[model samples]
Target: MTSPSTATLHPIGRSTPGTEWWRTAVIYQIYPRSFADSNGDGLGDLPGITAHLDDLAALGVDALWLSPFYPSPQKDAGYDVADYCDVDPLFGTLADFDVLQAEAHARGIRVIVDLVPNHSSDRHAWFQRALAAEPGSAERARYLFRDGKGDGGQLPPNNWESVFGGPAWTRTTNADGTLGQWYLHLFDTSQPDFDWANPEVQEEFRRILRFWLDRGVDGFRVDVAHGLVKTDGLPDHLPAVDGDSMGGDSDDVPYWGQDGVHEIYRDWNRVLAEYAGDRALCAEAWLPTVDRTALWVRPDEMHQAFNFPYLQTEWDAAHLREVISESLRAFPAVGAPATWVLSNHDVVRHTSRLALTAENPQGHGIGPDSPGQPIPEVGLARARAATAVMLSLPGSAYLFQGEELGLPEVIDLPGDARQDPTWFRTDGERYGRDGCRVPIPWQADAPAYGFSPSGATWLPQPAEWATLARDVQEADEDSTLWLYRTLLATRRAYALGSGDLEWLEGFGTDVLALRNGPVTVIANTGDAPVALPAALESATLLIASTPFAGTAVPADTTVWLLAG
Candidate 1:
């Protein structure tokens, strides 16, 4: 095959070139609760993270994106912040966090904490003070409050639905047995949404950002960044379906590109620009279209927003190519780089999403449920292809923990074991995320699979995961972990961090190819061997997901070719 040509891929933001290191970096997300445990409390902590810096360094990632470690009531796995600046006692002390940060930086791995600005725990001091109506209190403006009519009228200030499967507003009772003011929570009722429209709220959050940055944090992964702004009038939302009301109390809808969100991000970016060269901001944007997603990265806004289309879209070569192409093309116009993620804390793993078949694996045309067998060989192949495509693409990539090792989805959780709030809704029609959020399997033979010292872990480790633990795969060159390490190291070495992508024409539906300089990665997703292009015949193989049968590429294999 012809050696893939290197083309100039423009940066997305107005920051000077090389100033924003995150643009071309690979970020590894660590869900602290499931990462590792130090005190054997069945929970992972900062010190545990400190112990794993070497593993992350070995993975060759440029930065680490920790999910949430702040003080919380454990309602949403630490997403409900009780205190922004302090570390949760369940996780560890601030001193331990400092040590973790220091160790990570020493290993050249930048740390980015998840900052949940959309809401706070109802028990938060600000919310508590607002409840008592303290005079001249700044906390009163921290959240939205509205008067209620005692004549059986219980309307909220606005109509917004909580993301956790219910109405967003919750009414509080007054001391006189009448309905008092109501509070808005876009997610859980206990987690009240913040009033970002207030100038004081803006300044306080900005100060919070600075608080961490001054203490040596490299950046922040903003939570629900777009949800910061609400509609000005707080009008009842247009009903989508009959009986589909916001919390069964009102018809308020809460999301979808609310007004004033861009300006908020722009202002936040300006504050971040002061620390520009080394730090960055990654937004969690969930928009309907690629153009809308690009809007968040416009020059003075977020450096990069999560491109969720790929995570939620169907699996296919053609569809994947179209999404990648659109995202890449749209980014440069608005001065924001494209970011790719296959899995995160909120979604199922790719292995579960794209079920692979041993017979007909690899390629864009493969069906989502092709892999029905319990053995994950085909799923492993698909995961490898995903990594190859993600890293080879032009922008930044995010790798969820254990994903590098081809971890499959946890589908069978006992009813009582389920932790996700959504599972309890409607007789458990949804399986809840407790399965995917189980403890990481560190050692196959160790108790609790090396997730904790206790005999039992917080969640049962998939019995099938015993054969695929870190210790088991670390020694096997054909293991998924090995493939990930090699791919990550290669990308870092070749400056493949960012580049222009050229999709080869005439490739079969199951095959996808990307050219980034002198390297071309051809992934075969079918059951039969694919003929290598004449130009690639002279190329040397760097890695392959499956054994090569003669010169032609075997099915379910990723062939990395470099011109000789």
Candidate 2:
């Protein structure tokens, strides 16, 4: 295991001028907990990720975006880092991370880690020292603190609600039974928000960025990147639907986009750009509209912000076309290229999201054993349609772990077995994110579905998920994995990533036809078979979801045709 400090790190793709490489790159996101487990503890770790580097590289992704693996108390599944500099023992040692970085770089895959600067675990030494009233401590000032006064005298700086539900602030008790004044969290109460206004805090974070970059990290998928800044005056939030205040007096107090966030991101981007030197800064901004979201990627800010509209878009062909067109129009021409994500650790799997019918729509919404439903029989076809649209769009594509295998969302979890705090706090109305965060199934017949050889996994594996594991599907050329591989390989060969999208006019509402030079990708979203355009009548079929032995096309299929 070689440390990045000692390893001979190589730059990716000849360092093209500016950040153009991202325009055509395929980034594969790995949710560490579910990717693989090497310790048999039923938990995926850094070493497990290292072991599976070949799988990702073989998939032909240009880069790998790993979710947080920093040292933590397992609050928010390592998103709350107690220490940013070291690896959590459960995941593996720092040496293991260095080895993983080396291996990934060796395979021509750039590694981008998640950077959570908005907050740190409440248990972090800095926060702990602040609680002790350490004299003139720089750490104490790193967090927002104010004397309990004004308003109700017992009110927290302002009436802000936690994203996980409930009030954002928690009362602190001193050893002498005195009501000590302290400000806590914005997301999970366990994850304390940082005071970005402090100069020391800004400098420390900049150093943190440089630390990873100096260690040969390619870049970062900044977690909640827009949250570093807060409105100066702790203002009360307007009443939300539930009449609860959200996130103190801040510009971002509103549910989605806020004003002050841009400056914070711009500052971080400038610092990161100086350190990154062509590396990218992809953001996870859940802003309201595509135009508003594009504000974060104005060349001086984020290189790419995840376009979530595709995740929420309806399955109709026209609606999907509108989303892609709208995104391309919204993004700034000179900024980083646009990116798309169908599923991630935080959302329901696409299979579950798209599988719903009028009869089974409620089941698809959220519940236990949801993955085992016959929905895939209907959903897999939709999945192919979505893939064609997603890959053919003029932007980078991101695939969540197990997505290529057409894995469905997991819905069943006993009360005590739930891992997501959002689920517990929301009283099961949200069904928790645990369903999407389940361990990955690797073998159909292997115990624990090849995610582990030990007993039950930390989170229950989908009962029949083993059938869709990589090993099983890899052997079947017609499997979902094969389709994904073929699609990815073909798309790569044709420069689909960099090609300009030209939507073919006069196509039926169910058909989504886009041409990239002479190659045309035609997707059918309807149940009835549609005739191929006369212009494409003489075209050769490169790939099709259904058999293309003859000229007649099958229903619910996508055909990639090359102009003769």
Candidate 3:
């Protein structure tokens, strides 16, 4: 029996051979400002990425997912989009983006750009018009605006906090000298939430999707995918017992994962289907559970969603095993591929995160005074092991730029130099994400570490990153970069991206032995080494995260074994 998805050429998706290309593809995330700086403007532009496409192609990723490069005031580090149809001069022109896409396609790699339809920068043309127009006019109707509560309208309409911090609603002033309505901003004040109930808003987004699709983009990595619509009459969000106001629970939170989001993607899917290729949409929906997350990726909606369950699981073997089991069951039930991501522009680098015993409180960004003392050496070991096991699994994997070089979070960044809006919004209580977004180190001693010819970078680089520079790692086979290249090559060659998962019995609870097709992946997370059974010892050793050539798997290590 052929399902409708397989019956067709592709499911509004990514078709390379017969399978949807994104199902098993390795996608690399490039944070434009932190990637490379081509011009001498102390910032990274599209041409900087264009110049480094070869490096990504050599790394064996099937595609590259770019962070937002759209024109903006950059209030939220480009997440606050001022214009969807053009590129920001700080990044590059649309012409430069076209060149990069053409070059990437030429190298057989797909390009997926960040699509931020959840909200627009306050400086956006529509929002500016909405401000000038009367409250009941069509222009004002495009934004989420409501009169304040209380007799004098001095109080906010609702008691919702911003994702960054503080009140979610900001009051607006009219042509008169009096304060008027309050507008919702789930994130920063500069990013005003859109009125999704408006048909004009929906049509505008559909047009934006076609604008990028017509430009020959392979797909879109939707930002805040679950936040397309708020519940009718935007209610106050009451926190759970554990104090999770957002994330894989908190369904009662009126601003996220509403039923209305499904309809938006379904319509987007139809628009994608109208294209020639397997143009795809990957959702970043953070729902209450893996089961809930699966809803966003159903055949008629998005093709993939980030597997936060796997990334959120601690370093403990028992906990990880359980999460992996649940994810394998949940995603398959929906006929959608699960995406594995260890780090991204928003989170702390796993090189530091993997070493910490304590998890940061939800919505609390870790900064200079955060808990958990990070042991970099231990972190590097665990990061390598964790990535090896993640890549060997049967799904899409996203590699954050600089993960290949084993980059640790720049925890000691100077407070005076910090730029993340969370830092200011929280009055420096939260360190925010500026640390993990520093520029890539290309040379051990080149000016600005070869990030640009000007020897200038938007964010300062660590002086000690000389050893982790790509040039230094390129020559060392034991380098994390080399290991990544090897891992990617093996995964592609064995077609492990679309493999099946089956756990091998008899191994201790701390010893994870899972078979993905003919490839056996074993990870020993206990403090003691675990000996492989006779069957696996004789099996060929495809690769190991650590140095090993024995029948026993070392502690905190992962190995991929090829069966005869």
Poorest lDDT segment (10 consecutive residues) of candidate 2: 242-251
Tens-digit lDDT string for candidate 2 (1-564): 332233444544446654466777888999888888888898898988887877776677888898988889987999889999888888898899888888888777888889998889988998888887742466578887665656534767677667666676776666677676657577787888888778787778878888887778878898876566666676776434432122221234533345666777777777766653367788777654677678888877778888866666767889888878888888746455678888888766777777664222211235653434437666777776687678776778888998888888775667678877666666754455777788888888887888876745889886778788889998998887887888788888888877788988777888888897667888778877778867788998877875555354556678888988
lDDT of each: 0.74, 0.74, 0.86
Give the winner by lDDT: 3
Which segments of candidate 3 are over 4 A away from where they belong? 1-18, 240-246
What is the alpha-carbon RMSD of candidate 1 to the true structure? 7.0
Runs of candidate 2 with Cα error greater than 4 angstroms are: 1-9, 12-14, 134-138, 147-152, 182-184, 238-256, 275-277, 357-365, 369-374, 546-556
Better of 2 and 3 by lDDT: 3
Q: Model 2: what TM-score?
A: 0.90
Q: Model 1 misses residue 130 by how many Å? A: 1.7
- Descending-lDDT candidate ranking: 3, 2, 1
lDDT of 2 at 564: 88
Candidate 1 residue spans exceeding 4 A from truth: 1-19, 134-139, 147-151, 155-159, 238-254, 356-375, 425-427, 526-528
Error of 1 at 18 (Å): 4.2
Model 3, 1-564: lDDT tens per residue?
111111222234445533778888899999999888888788888999988888888899999999999999998889999999999999989999988887788777889999998899999999999999887889989999888899978999989888787899999987887888899998999999999999999999999999998888879999889897888877777555434334555666788888989999999999998897788899987776788888999889998998776776777778888878888888888788878888888877888888876666444555667788688888888899999999989889999999999999898888898999888898988788898899989999898888988989888999878999999999999999999999999998888889888988899888878898888999887878899888777889988998887689988899999887
